[model samples]
Each structure stands twice: as C-alpha cells, then as structure tokens.
Target: KVMGILPFSAPSCGLITKTDAERLCNALVYGGAYPPRCKKEMNGGSLELQFTDRSFKVYHECFGKCKGLFVPELYTSPNAACIQCMDCRLMYPTHKFVVHGHKAQENRTCHWGFDSANWRAYILLGQDYTEKEEKARLELFLDEIKEKFD
Candidate 1:
C-alpha cells in the first residue's frame, strides 16, 4: 500500500520532483505552523487553514480544520521524507505515528548534504535538519522532533 503512494518508494512513478516536494513540504509546514486566530465557539481551539491551488484538497484542508472534523479518525504520514520531519506526531493524541528505526541503529542511516568540515554527516535526515522544521513552530506542540538529535 505504501509503495502505491510513496514516490521515493516507487520506481515506476517519477512525478514527484525535488522542487514540487519542497513546495508541498513548505505548504504543509506553513499550514501546520500558522493556525488562524479564530477559534471554536465552545472549546476556544483554533480552527483554521490556508489552502493552495495544488493542495491535495481533502487531507490538506483538514490539516487546518477543527478537531472534530473527522468521524472515524485519520492518520497522517510520520516521516514526511520530502520535508524531513520525524516527531511532529506528539502534538495531538489522535495524531498517530509510524516508527521507522532507532537513531543509534546503524541500519537506519543517511548522508545529508556534505558540509564544509569534509566529513560525511551520516545521521538522521542526512544532516540537513531533517527532523527540524525550517519553518514549523518549535515552541509549540511539535517540539519532540525539533532538535537535530533528540
């Protein structure tokens, strides 16, 4: 099932471009970052979203929707490989996660962009601030996966 959707996982589909993924990642991060100042009349929780023309529609809209929008409950992707975030699931109880591998595990290693030290940064997110959000809010609920190593 994952192979059907994940671009990096699938060989046949090359529709996922580097820039497109980056844009999508940025949109999602921004949507998650800035919640509208409005609030639920009863609960006072923010119910907001900023949609784009290229957004996937349903899932994207709901990302900024109120808490009770869904009935059966839906689960989002854990390691948004395109954006490189890992632990944002700690925000809400209903938001679930898919654990890939332990940080110290040698098997789950990656080489991010090469840096100036001339040493390969073989760690999670390839040393490109994988888990850290370049735009996502750090002081909010998405703190667990904010640091380079947590």
Candidate 2:
C-alpha cells in the first residue's frame, strides 16, 4: 500500500492538518492508504451453488505516512455568547457512545466532547469497546472503509 496522507504543517495548530485524522482512520479502517479491502469467505458455498448470509466481520488495517495528532477541543465552549467552531453545530446536548465489536465487556466505553456543539459526533457514537478491542475493531473498520472509499 502506498502512503497517501502527504504530511504538511498546520499553521494555527502548530502541527499537521486535521485531514490526517481521517487519513489514519481511513487506513486503520481500510487496507492501503486508500482503504482497500480484501474480502474472505468462510461460508461453505459457491456462486453457482447458492448464497446465504453474507454477514461478516470488518477490519481496518493500519497504514499511514505518519501518526495524526488528535485535535481534542479545549479552552472554550462551542456554544458561548458568540458561538464559533464545530461545537456550536448542535445546541442541544446529547450523549453518544462508542461500542465494542462481537466481543465486548459490558459498561466499557469512552466519552468525550461534552458541552460542545459537535454533540452530534458524541450523540452518534455507536457501539462500545475496550482500548485493545477498539484498536482491533478500528483495523477491521479500515478494511470496510477501503471497500467503500477506494
């Protein structure tokens, strides 16, 4: 897989562009830097014979030019007297959760981005997972991303 996220510095953040976040996500969820997936079948059947549940697990392999810095919002409210930044997108507060994969322990999840307008991202958080599982699931997701994005 070729490296796709051309690294460049972000003037304001004094780091790299935020697109790197998506790129790392894309790679971890896809195969190559472009998120390519190679599907394998375990179901016992052939195309000429029949087709059953196509359901399967997903993975997002790791592949990126470099590690992307996380832009965790800080220092201000997204919905202040003069709303600005992404946190102000959704005025209503909500709680979105992250979930684990086929194997996950109950009551295990991470929460972030509170009191911000980007609550949709928080509210839309799907599923739950452990730190180790998140890494594994992320690789699987990257594979899926490759299938769609590539």
Which model scores highest in TM-score?
2
What is candidate 1's local distance difference test score?
A: 0.25
Residue 86 lDDT (model 1): 26
lDDT of candidate 2 over 1-150, digit per residue (tens): 134333333233445433344333433542211101212342442111111232112111112111111111210233211111121111111111111112222111212222222323222212233478765765464344324312
TM-score: model 2 vs. ground truth: 0.18
Residue-level lDDT tens digits of model 1 in 38-141: 33352644343322231111111111222111111112333222121222211221221111211222212222432212211111112222355632332232
Give the lowest summed-lDDT range of ten residues in model 2.
Answer: 91-100
- Model 1 / residue 112 / CA error / Å: 25
Clashing pairs in 1: 112-126
C-alpha RMSD of each candidate structure in angstroms: 16.2, 20.2
Q: Judge candidate 1 at residue 142 and give its lDDT.
A: 27
